[model samples]
Target: MKKWKAVLTALLATGMLTGCLGNGGGSTLNSESSRIYVTEEGTFQTATVESYVQQDYYNGDELKTFLEEAVSQYNGANGQNQVTLDSCTLDNGTAKMMFHYASPDALIGFTTQYEDKENQVESIAVDKLSEVYGQSESEGVTFIKADGKKADQKAVSKRGESQTVVVTSANPVTIQTQGRILFVSDNVVIKDSHTVQTTKGKSYIIFK
Candidate 1:
């Protein structure tokens, strides 16, 4: 009713959505916490699983409705279904909301509209990683494997047609990709070969 972001802040402030934060992420089959799934084509889906507590003054159903309406409004104004709320459900005080975006740009626009400026996916590029990030690849641009091992410098130098994702986020969430992650930024936590979690500030992932 009062726009989605404001309402969510109010709900959290009122303790209607109260619970411990999550450390892991989820996939299409199971979403343990909140995670973003990215494909080779750059389209992605997000599973937002947050804890909540039932209270007489706060209605979970109403919150779901508000979320749906917010997504719908954003899509409608964009003149296409660039963003869609795949599902929203509350069970045992845990709320899971799934959103599918046509592209990374769609997600950027949606987040911008909600005033969530801290989380930004600025660019998904196929150019040289150093050029995209405006740094010298020769200047010890540290790139580590998903296992936190130093990636093969030879392999990095020989990169060809690789997809690079440049993201800046203060929130903690795991990002999953279908391709083998060649390297990730310093602030990223190694989740697995195919996934990495953001710690803070700027982070990048290069995948085949």
Candidate 2:
């Protein structure tokens, strides 16, 4: 198999990591080494995996340790509701750490406090999926036709957004003035300035 590199995004980072790296640095949780290295600008804190010795393989132990460290650091530094690691999972060298925080503002505060320490946990999941799948497919962004004639009509995703519509007619199609044509099968034709262009002019345009 190919050598794979999994990148775990840090939804939480301790003040120590941020102090050194700035707020964009990351913490590396290594399963094989049973250790976590918190990196900031260019410095890091090397800690033994002692804090997570009893947890499962999915880096739950390491995640808990990180969260504890982060919360402690945040509380001591800012005296606020610190972030918590809600869940964790490890696959293909990537560690996924989910966290629960008060709000985006709180999240930003946490990030600012430990920014040199990294990206959110969602990116780790993204990396894992990217590694497992190798490639990705995306349907291009669609611009809605909200102001056109069919204002009330919604745009349905029929296959990819890049597809085009093809319209064909079997009979003498009538394009009415109001952009709508009612084809009366010889039953009724309430014509009030709504003209129907026919291929052949017939007397009894039998619109019963």
TM-scores, all candidates, are 0.73, 0.29
Count steric clashes of candidate 2.
14
State the lDDT at 168 in candidate 1.
61
Worst 10 residues of 2 by lDDT: 120-129
In the range 1-208, model 1's lDDT, one tens digit per residue, is 3454465666544545422334443333235555667777767776666665454545656767787787889988885888888877767767777778887778778755654322335443334454554452634457787668887766765665676766666565567766777888777787766677777666678877
Deviation in Å, model 2, residue 126 alpha carbon: 25
Model 2 regions lying over 4 Å from their true place: 1-60, 116-208
lDDT tens digits, residue span 67-128, model 2: 56766787677656555544455445334444445443444456445442332111111012
Q: Which is the leading candidate under TM-score? A: 1
Q: Whose lDDT is greatest here?
A: 1
| Model 1 ranges off by over 4 Å | 1-9, 12-30, 56-64, 115-140, 170-173
TM-score of 1: 0.73
